[model samples]
Target: MRAARLRRGLAMALTACSIVVTVAAAARSTVPGTPVPPRLPAMRAETLPARYAANHRFITESEHAARALGDEGRAGVLARLARGDRHFLSFSPRGDGQVVEVLGDLAHADRIAVVVPGSDTTVDTFDELGTVYASLNGGARSLHAEMRKLQPDRKTAVVAWYGYPAPRTMSRDIVTTDRALDGGRRLAGLVGDLRRVNAAAPVAVLCHSYGSVVCATALRRMDAPAESSLSDVVLFGSPGTGVRSRAELRTRVPVWAGRGATDWIEGVPHVSLDLLGAQIGFGTDPVAAPFGARLFPAGAGSHSDYLRPGGLPLRNIALIALGRGSEVSDD
Candidate 1:
């Protein structure tokens, strides 16, 4: 009787999740306008400081326009951008999805960490306030603080990258690579842009969950920037890196993988497919022996706990961002 009740309850919860996801996806698709940020001139490392100012001006204009259009929520986003408190690398007010954040100084930071988030993230949720370093923006802020604590003399920056559309909770898209493939190329290109702007600094991509798929997509491309420009690619709470082996990634930089002991993803079968010779599910467990990623210790918790402050995962992520892998705990 207890088992039956448990099964029934689980089914009901899944059904509710399916309904919410479908409705959200439908609402997202029905919306016609995808608000784009105002155009700015071509960028160069030396001119990025000024470009940030110019972009902020355009965002402010758009925010006011959104207010006139009676979109108070969007206007609120614009208002936040207008506050001059953040160093935004890019922002798009129109889409339910986008990237609009930065932590610490970017123009001259000697080390940088670009965080790629996973499922169900949107522009609105990107800025959603959370307690205890729970939100992506908050987590980035936490990581930046950790970096500062580790090396007060060194400059550091963390980017909360959320440009790609995430798979909804029950959408079939979540089980497929339709989004990850595109997101991967964009992520790689963005890394190249960071490379050009901060030429002397070491940069890393800290991929969590589905974001690992995006990171793998870029690294597999022949045209992607050479490994020297990227310091590391770390996968945490990863589904897979979308490769047969780390060597298959076709990059020279060391690839690292970690998972908290309690992370549910650890039990997911590592398998990817190319149906009839087309790309599909990403395969290979990043932390498994066959995956060939340098295994590192992570804090004990579920998927979202990797970036929590005072945790092993956060500390190791900071160490990797600062290129101090030797300092990471090896348990």
Candidate 2:
């Protein structure tokens, strides 16, 4: 029985790699007049409880670009953003897709939650009405709303980080840590920027699916000050964090993991291997005993169900983000 399960796991991982290689090769053949990636400007310095004029300028430009292009769906989201006190850390209409939007006032916020999205998520999908990845925008809004409901006086913010290009499919891109490594560096830079923005404010990162791998990498590389201020990290519906144990994540802060009973990620093999000179397939299930993370109560729901309105997972995640750890429920 053990051998059979192992074989099945190995087959799944290999199949994912082979399919990804083919897709990657085909993608390399570029078509004529394919739009080139956007060139972003240099980042400007901004103080904590401070604002960057450069970022705001980029936001205005991006909003104009969306509206000028006659993309109603994209324009609508930008229109809403224009009316709000939305503080944009960065924005670029690159083919790679990049955006860092903050809901609530980060300048005055005492607590912040950063949501790192998984595969198939992109700046374009933020307003894509019907897909699960649309939550790339909605999920943060739900979390921010739930956090406020607990105590309206508490100042909190939710950041939807679409800075890294997510893998288009769940095949080899996920099995490898290459993208996660890039994402990790971006995450680290964000954390560093946040520290400069408000070092005293507590920050929590909510990582989903492949995003968990990105979070783990960031944790391992982030400077001590940035790590110190990041109070918690919640991994929900995570396939694997690419680390064998939470301790391997190299942060003293609290690391939490949760999964709904119906989450399909439970079926994925929790194993790792080295293939073609790259470490593939993260090992050890995060919610399992050996992964060494605090388990939280996540009600029965499938992948993408964690941040749904009124879900148990949303509640607990908010508590963690709010630094009200005592209020979180154990599974």
Candidate 3:
């Protein structure tokens, strides 16, 4: 009886969301930034510096395209990305855009954190707010800085991986697992590549909101589990992970969940049901005991505050990345 009621509620919500999605898609039909043309080929370089140089050239070309389209704001963003200081493993100006930016030395880092952002992420809003350690790159820098402070002797790196076309916040796509599935396939490939590049480094994945769903799928699809480089998987302010429990993830590493006291996602319904021949909603609140994930303190942070500088959540995430999970504070 209770399950039936939950299904009915979810169906209603999905119906409403579908209508909104139609309107939003129509509105975006003539959007200014439709992916720039003349896509470049992927770099075949094995060295990190060569890969960075090739990606920088792509960014520069993308900036020119943005300027030609009269999008100064986007061009400006791309300009900064093409700078000599920035190191990108991948860059694409197609669709909503994608980037895999690395902070710190990737080749020699013994500790690495891969950050997967939530919905509404794109190249345009990549550095949104521009606050210290708030934007995508800033947050990566924050985590890297925190990890360095925790273990100055250990080499650390953070990858801000926006490798998929994240759905808009109000889109129906955000509510479903379609994007997450695609994102997971890509994420799984990335993890495989990372393992090949640095087989011994302890890697941690920090998934935020919808990214949790993506991370879960990646874990499910990954092969060669015994050689996995993943040391931890941390989900913060997540809606759901599309799984009932952490055991379903089949991960040997610790699965951690955390949510700030003031996070709005706490109110999202933690239920999944079949509706319209599709999976509606992600299942189980990850932080709940039923999910069987180790709970970590996130302090009083909102949905976007988990990676903010000086936040308790950021500190804990850093600790997890550094393989110092025991030092993570309960308070």
Candidate 4:
């Protein structure tokens, strides 16, 4: 009777959470955008210039569309992105849009870090060196800058990939893995491109919040050897990763997990539930002992503070990305 009562209570709580999230999401204004080209050139060292040109064209066109829609905020952002200095592997203006931006010399870098952002991220909110909490653009720039500071001689690169439509926080979608599953496939595709272009670079994926779930799903689909260039998976500020333990992930790379001392995600329930044939929660707190992820230090910060500039989390993340995980100080 106790077990049954527990399940019943969980179902009720989940239902309430979903309703609240859905209502909040409904109150937000949706951004208007144009459809991106259906096809683009494949990523290769020799074809990089062509890809840049294509992205520039897309950015220009998207800017025009945003201007037409009177969303000067997004139009201005796109205008800046179209500048000659910017480097984007891919760009799309559909829905919340997607951007794959490179922060360093990707063609020659020996170490690469892919920053996967969580919910409430969009092109309009993507900051370069500016401060915007949880912005993929800001986080990627911060991580790359930290990596360079730590190892000036190391050839490193960082990719800010907003390739998936991250759901709004506190929304019904965030409670389920549907978006994460789709995001994982997209992330896998991005990794495939990276491997093709720089097969020798050791790569680390730094996933935050909902992005952790996406990374876990992607890792499960990969069967790389223990010595593969994909070196590590780092999860921070995560609620759960859809798996109870690292062994279930089945990826050869080392899995690391951490949380800022005051991250709000710690309060989120870390249990899965079956509700009318649909799974309503991600399973397992990755930092928990049973999950088997190597722990790292995140210091004191909130949910969006993990990637803050000069923070301990950013430094350790850079260390892991550079294949120097042994040097990360968990204390």
Candidate 5:
């Protein structure tokens, strides 16, 4: 009886050990099927706040000056103004004294659009430029509204970038090109940050007016390994982007160009050769150009009508944002 009892106990012990071993093996085999999520960049809390403060200080001084001056004083007042109030400016970082508005979560956005404004644009003037001329001349708000309408399901963000020191006026001088290049670099950096924060998102750049010049310059200067993440580039009412040809821009990214027939840029000399002073020009008109951009038939409104509500330009932009050109109405 004693021997039988001992045998039974040993048998039970062996069974328990086997069960433990099997459970351990099962646990080891059950690895997670989901992918390890990508890490986001560590954004220092202080960095953005500090930048905002500087911007506020600059804008406050300018606004006070403008208020002191009468209606006649408004004529010479700076065309561009920073976007934020004193608190916003106080927290933001200064990048070439340009305006930078962060609209969405850079970490998980589905789509990102960067709107680079043109000549005489500053942080303050960013929004007003659209409203002052008429309801038809809507600015950043119009662009944002159109984008949201187009991409209702996806996370979309628009950056009203006034980062480059734009020319105060239209000038043939090299300063215009220099300022554009500066803006482009800043844009490139911003793009890099966006990508670092969310590698899966697509980024599109809309360069308006002289901002196109900056975009072109940045593309030309960007070397290999630094050029990815840009899915599309659109230029509106651009005189020139400093590239002799679209191919010279050296970007695999699709280039979209368009200008209203009545755009003043058409009248400006297209090229600057020493002997020609400013030549009529060569290369394709962005609107009619062979490049794959969806051409919007902007009527006689010139450079400023691109963002007007219910307009062809805004509709086309909306289509681009939504990733569907087929939805755009001809009207």
Candidate 6:
């Protein structure tokens, strides 16, 4: 009886070993013959940045942008931007995974408006904002579409510049601004590139939310003799542009500021130093501030509604783009 029990135990051990071997073989077979897919050659292990120890963060951010735009199939826009392809001229990368978009005509365009977006903005957000909020594509597509509708013969284009790493939340405004300086430098480079392409093109930068910070940093870095013909810099839903007052921004260019009555950003503190030793200051309310900027009327809603389709702020932007500044009416 004892001999029979020993034989049975040996048989069970052999079965268990066989099962383990089979599972190991199956796991090996599941791996691709080429571990890296041919399509995503740039995303291979060796090519990834050493700093991105959390490589998954890049993938997550890309997927978030893609899903936001409602285009699950083309979720690789941010990834592609990292690879330096301009297929998404509406979105291009400056560094890391930050993407920007340049719209309108590249040559001989009468007016150019660069729309800098804020937080959580990735290449994918462009599509999502366009798809979900048809009015909010920074009013970019709609603004351009309306321009075409109003005057088919006119030349105009809107650039969606997301050249900086935007804060995921308002709490990170300071952190976001720090990174935006780098983006601002890149934008200044783009300005040079644009001038080289067309010296006669009039340029304007429309900064929204935290984008105002990026524009402020860019303008600050410009020397007085620089040929950057940035005619107008408009800020909407701005927390602060790191200047005590609009005049302290030190640009010969006109600075435009506006905010909706219900906008939460109005509550943010607007305090910064000026070129002079004096403390140039902005108020809790941008509309009430002494900045030389022309305050336009923003309708009801939080900060995100300025560029909504059919909104007053967007119409004002369209007016600015068309060079009809006097036509802009206050809300």
Q: Please give the CA lDDT of all the candidate structures.
A: 0.75, 0.78, 0.81, 0.82, 0.57, 0.57
Residue 180 in candidate 3, Cα distance off native in Å: 0.5
Give the TM-score comparing model 2 with the true structure, all chains together: 0.85
Q: Compared with the true structure, what per-residue lDDT tens digits does model 6 show for residues 251-315?
A: 77777778877988765445442312322222233455565677766677578777777778777
lDDT tens per residue, model 2, 123-165: 5676442644336778888899999998799899888998886
Candidate 4 local lDDT, 189-273, one digit each (tens)? 7787888788888889999999999998888775464226688999999988988889998876899999998998887777777
Residue-pair clashes per candidate, as listed? 2, 1, 0, 0, 22, 8
- What's the alpha carbon RMSD for model 2? 3.8
Per-candidate TM-scores read: 0.85, 0.85, 0.90, 0.90, 0.66, 0.66
Off by over 4 Å in 2: 20-85, 129-134
Candidate 5 segments whose C-alpha is farther than 4 A from its true place? 1-96, 130-138, 170-176, 223-226, 274-284, 288-296, 326-329
Candidate 2 lDDT score at position 108: 72
* Tens-place lDDT digits, model 5, residues 1-331: 6455445434433343344222223323422321222232244333545545555555555445545544223323333334353222111112213346656544567877777777766434544654643221235557767777766777876666666666555233222355665667877776776666566778788788777878877787765544677777878777667666678788897777767767887754443332223222223345545434455555556788877776787767656655564554556
Candidate 1, superposed: residue stretches over 4 Å from native = 1-36, 129-132, 222-226, 275-280
The better candidate by lDDT, 1 or 2, is 2
lDDT score for residue 163 of model 5? 63
By TM-score: ranked, best first: 3, 4, 2, 1, 5, 6
Candidate 3 local lDDT, 1-331, one digit each (tens): 6677586558655764666455334434443544443333443225677778777877897788789899898789899888889998888776467789988877778988999988878877677744545567778888888889888999988989999777777777777888899999999888777776677787899999899999999999888742278989999999999988999987777999999999999877777877677677888899999999998999998888988888899999889888888888955
* Residue pairs with clashing backbones, model 4: none
